[model samples]
Target: MMLTILAIDDSRTIREMLRETLRNAGFDVHVAVDGLDGLEKLHDIAPDVIITDINMPRLDGFGVIEAVRAGTSHAALPILVLTTESAPDLKERARKSGATGWIVKPFDDAKLVSAIKRIAAH
Candidate 1:
């Protein structure tokens, strides 16, 4: 079965772009505008991996990672926190919250896809 990826970011353009790119890469894609929305989507369907941004309305990437780690259904799921922030402290916090890795924003599709492939074992 194809891996399903849940990508949460505030930018509609970024979410759409990621959905299209991941779909083309042979993975199922789901989108959310922010961390709250991501959690809602998670209730509907559990994704193999979650890619998210750190800054957003309602809730941020850290909150998403925290919620996921606390949730019994999603605690074991892989997460990739994609954001503009490069701070070591933020990355460390995300790691503590259960993020598998980090990626900078405005990232290339190849780099993003490569990250997903590695996470999904594609």
Candidate 2:
């Protein structure tokens, strides 16, 4: 089965990059402008994995993770935080918020795909 991914970011370029990368890797990619939009799309898409930016308008990655974890249906879904922040505290906070993994921005396409595949396999 083709896995579906929901990628949320404020940057259009990042979203486009993720869409292209994931699509080329044979995954269905859906995108949202921010965390609020991500939450909305979450219900509609029921994606196998989610990639979200840490800093954004409306809501942020932590908020998105919290919201997803609050719900029963998608609570167990793999959520990867894609951000420029590489601070250990930030990563810890993301983990506390229920994120499955972390990827610093300017990510390697191959590593991203591998991470997604690994998470989806679980």
Residue 85 Cα positional deviation in candidate 2, in Å, after optimal superposition: 0.4
Clash count in backbone of candidate 1: 0
Question: Which one wins on TM-score?
Answer: 2
User: lDDT by residue for model 2 over 84-103, one digit each (tens)?
Assistant: 99999999999999999999
Whole-model lDDT per candidate? 0.90, 0.97
TM-score of each: 0.93, 0.99
Question: Which residue runs does candidate 2 get wrong by more than 4 Å?
Answer: none
The digit string of per-residue lDDT tens for model 1 on 4-109 reads: 9999999998898898988998889999999999999997878989999999999999999999999897788889998889999998998988899899988888
- Residue-level lDDT for 39 in candidate 2: 98
Winner by lDDT: 2
lDDT of 2 at 12: 99
Error of 2 at 111 (Å): 0.2
Off by over 4 Å in 1: none
